[model samples]
Target: MGAQKIVRQEADTVGENPLRLEKEKAEQIVDALNTDLADAYVLYHQLHKHHWNVEGAEHLGVHEFLEEAYEDVEDAADELAERVQTLGGVPHASMTALSEAATVEPEDEDVYDVRTSFENDIEMYGSIMESYREHIELAENLGDHATGELLRQHLLELEEHVHVMDHYLEDDSLVQS
Candidate 1:
């Protein structure tokens, strides 16, 4: 067979071509996913650290809730990384990458207060929700229905988390003297 035929055979064997426009679309989705994953991971670590070290009246509630959120976000990060790898791209994990990509600001050393923590979490979750929604849109545009469906489920969960955190933060404001 000719060289072009061999290239076509290889491409067929490996499934979709990764260098095409669709792969670029996949990469675009992965870029947003990568940023969100980094942000979520950073927030997850910060929440876990705060959970261990928080010293206040709502310590247990805050710690336990934050841990739950952390677990959810960690799972999401794993799935997104796998998706990135599936698209023949690397998912970033370094702290430097997280710092640069994070839409959620770094956890303040002085932000140990329950209300502050909740506010930070609400902001982070909101950013994540937006990214997930955008990923869903991109998946739809690319005709990747399976990815779109998966992203919808993840977006729903993120929305719920954001709503719950928002409620908690609002309640915290109300409870303040």
Candidate 2:
């Protein structure tokens, strides 16, 4: 009788569903999704730029890696934009808007040396990881576990890119020596 009573109480509490968000949480989540979308779009552009311009003997290696990176970034971009729209926010569309709002800088063709590319990629990935961390935290705070998990996966992939690029950067120095 005691166990049955306890189960009834638990079922009643579960039916009450205490985790529903007030309006503020929804607004915060939508804002975060929009900001992340804009940033991801900018990063996609940078990766595509790198993919098109990387040269020398490592061109094939770098080009292939960059293409993969950009593809991932492009997916993130599309997801983010759609997510923003789903939340009723307009994603930044113009190049000027993206450039102004982006945390990462636009890529410069003149600075496309192997060493410079590696260094810039590291910097970009670091910025991206940091931003993703913030987004993950925000999503978690808003009880958006799915978004948090996605950001975690994205952060891990970016970390791997940074590690692989580190090797290339080191190798570039050895070649000069």
Candidate 3:
């Protein structure tokens, strides 16, 4: 049987949200959350790829770190999706939808050295971080304090991982050039 839409929730319409945020503001917040959700999935997959492909003397450490980071990204993605739903918006779930909505780019399938992977990861994380900052401000200006707080927490976590990745890039670090 061919897949078909049955009970379709219109993409552009806002439903009854318990949060009671104004419709326009809720729509804006939902759009931001969906974008973050899409970016999180992209970052998660990249981290998972690096975790599987990492090699060299520092392989074990880098691999474990990537696993932990990917897990965290997954958690954040879940939160973003939940927030989107709470705001009466459909969360972007399909790969095409997510890829289209994501602002951050992922690296290609080629397996790079750990250092190269970390460099790419750092760049993606930075982009996501910047996006989150804007989202937090957007939420705050819209009087959605809950969403702003959520983004703020995710930003701090992403920043922590980026800091660790930066140290891994240092000349004296184990995963170095």
Best by TM-score: 3
lDDT per residue as tens, model 2, 26-127: 556656666666677867777787788888877898899989988987777777766544444455667776666677775665747767877877887888
Output the lDDT of residue 137, model 3: 97
What C-alpha lDDT do the candidate models reach, one value each? Answer: 0.69, 0.70, 0.92
Error of 1 at 2 (Å): 41
Ordered from best to worst lDDT, the candidate numbers read 3, 2, 1
* Candidate 1 per-residue lDDT over residues 42-153, each given as its tens digit: 8778767767776666667767877787788788778877776676556776778767877777576765676677777777777777777877888778776666787787
Top lDDT prediction, candidate number: 3
Extract clashing residue pairs from model 3: none
Q: Return whichever of 1 and 2 wins on lDDT.
A: 2
Sort order, TM-score high to low: 3, 2, 1
What's model 3's lDDT at 152? Answer: 94
